[model samples]
Target: MRDLVRKYKDFLAVKGVTFDVPEGEIFGFLGPNGAGKSTTIQILATLLKPTEGTAVVNGFDIRNEPDKVRQSIGLVFQDPSLDERLTARENLYFHAMLYNVETTIMKKRMAEVLEMVELADRQKDQVKTFSGGMRRRLEIARGLVHYPKVLFLDEPTVGLDPQTRKRIWEYIHYLRDKEGLTIFLTTHYMDEAENCQRIAVIDHGEIVALDTPENLKSVIGGDVIKISTDNNEEVLPVIKNRLQVKAEKQGDYIAIQVEKGEIFIPRLAVELKGRINSMVIKKPSLDDVFLHLTGREIREEGVNAVDRMRVYSKRKH
Candidate 1:
């Protein structure tokens, strides 16, 4: 989508943002909560229209051909979207009917999807009785009933256990490899984003960075050294003057980047023997990349309803 925008009255939920995904590629929109990731996905999936620009999903224009767009794509929302009273198989069957899957093959497709999610034996069980992971898997299976060209997964693994999250990723990879399906996913979990082929790091409705996980981490340029001291104010200048390294104050610690963090640590210890309290050295990560770009952690709590309401009020007047 080119220059896509979405406004909720004066809130401006999504800004002018644009990017494209290759066929059959797993592209991720990686961001913290409420960074416009869901809003962009909603527009591309044709559930919400763009206020300024447009998108094409599976060769169908999201605006001019919404029905075609809907036909070509499947969606698994962030929240559970299943009928608790219905059995797992019944849920899939209902979804198949809504998507107009051929009745002749619906049963076969239902069985296949159930088996794919490893829920075949439990297909007869009511959805309310299933665990959280099982429900998520069932929802994913339902999304594939009609064989969509692209699948949109919004926080697909949220609230799932580590084992369950891993299994879900296995199923996702299986679908991509077997069916050659294109997957567009939104996630706040950094670990989940690492599984994607490419990622767009968004903040405040803007793409701060876009690249492979390795490439994004490489942008940090070296190892990270974090130090804690009783007098951060006293140590900051001494380190800069003696080591000729720029250090950033983060709370009660100082963060420094160097080619070799281990070597830097020994030097730091020798130079300032009694002043340091604690220290850690490690390689760069996605969190570091985000902090480097935004000067704040991505997971920081964002604007609240009252703040948005203030903006809305100003716009109304």
Candidate 2:
């Protein structure tokens, strides 16, 4: 997407965001709730039109060739969209019909996808009888029924358990490595973002940072030293003045960012020996990278007014 913009009356939900995803790579949009990740995906999937700018998906321009764009992309919605009354196979068949998969190979394609997600055994069962994870897997299978070039997974494992989430990611990787499908996903889970070859961190409708996870974390430039003490208020300034390093109170610990935390730790231990309660050293993580860029931690939030407006507008449109 180049210079993509989306407006909801006075609120700008997506601000001139621009990026490209290499074919067959797992590309992630990482951010907290209401960060325009979904909006940008919707525009690319041809579910919503951008107010300005355009993107080409699978060799088709999103604006001028929406039908072709839709044909080339598969979508797994953030929310469940399966027909509970339909059987697993029925769901896949319905989706295949929508995408106009040739009748001669529809059943073969359905079986292939069902097996890919390990849901072949339960294909005849009603969707209502399936577990959350099972249903999610079925949804994924349904999305692939027509063999699209790109798959858009909007928070594919949002509410699944850790084990289930892991299994889902396994399937995602298999899709990329085995099927050679370009995977575009939006997520708030830092670990999930790590799975992507590249990530675009968005907040409040703008792309704040985009890079490989390793590269993004390198921006922190060193290890993180977290110190816990009884008198945080007194020790905070002392450490800042003594070491002349960046130190701030993060909850119960004073987080210090510096190069070579191991070298810094012993000197710190000696200087604050009597007062220090505990100390922990760790490498920088995606969470730290996000905090460093946004000046805040990612937190769950309800749908913002702009998101609500976008939804209502989508329905109206």
Candidate 3:
């Protein structure tokens, strides 16, 4: 966790970030690539001491009591950490040994975790032979081999297919409900964050908002109004003062966060009748919240959408 913190902060990436993950809650860390989500997680997981602020996990300061914080949490990193050469069972066994689980409990617990993740059949197979999903499940099992009280999943389901991603979502709930483990997850996936008890949204290294999914959605006015238009250089400020909420210009669409789009739609329809070719109204999404806060798309500048989608994929989102 601490190592990850430093990796992201060496260039002074984070700024005035502060939040807490309550016990027994599935807390989400939401942000784009350079939003400082990873940097904060590294500190919380005891991987890196913050260059400034400090995080305390399980009552121990992340900077001064790193070992205590480490003891209380399990971390599954953004990058693949599993050994391709090792079989799933071997991987769990190795981690179990490192954690000093009692001999009698190690075998039983290993079996339990493997079965829980539905990787029991593949326990004997080398990770390299497994598909992307299999390796991820095995990595999750390994993270749980020691049964730490809190588990940090960084972009938990990155490369898996839809079905696999859904399976992993169920597993995350299982960790919280059955195993009594508090799951700390950082993801771009709106669906995944919906499952969290609480969520903190960060942008540009600052936490923009924190609340349950419903509460967060409730903050936005009403239905979302999306317009097809351009010349953001011309329309943005006008819309901002008119709407009193965020107006994001993407390609030809200007998405506005409003309380009552039913009324705003018609009024806005007339206001920009010729400016925009068309408009639509729908429910708000995490994308809207993110846009409201940062005024930028999830895969903002420099990060290619397909490449970001393909590499981080379901893992973050």
Off by over 4 Å in 3: 1-10, 229-246, 267-279, 301-317
Best by lDDT: 2
Question: Which candidate model has the greater TM-score, 1 or 2?
Answer: 2
How many steric clashes does model 1 contain? 0
Per-residue lDDT tens digits of candidate 2, residues 43-86? 99999999999999998999999999999999999999999999
User: lDDT of candidate 2 vs native?
Assistant: 0.89
Q: Write the per-residue lDDT of candidate 1 for residues 17-37, one digit (tens) a residue.
A: 888899998888988777798
The deviation in Å at residue 136 for candidate 2 is 1.1
Every candidate's lDDT? 0.87, 0.89, 0.78
**Candidate 2, pairs of clashing residues:** none
TM-scores, all models, native as reference: 0.89, 0.89, 0.84
Model 3 lDDT, residue 290, Cα:
69
> Model 2: how far is 135 from its true place, Å?
1.3
In candidate 2, where is summed lDDT lowest over 10 consecutive residues?
Answer: 305-314
- Highest TM-score scorer: 2
Per-residue error for 163 in candidate 2, Å, reads: 1.5
In model 2, which runs have C-alpha deviations exceeding 4 angstroms?
231-238, 248-252, 270-278, 300-317
Better of 1 and 3 by lDDT: 1
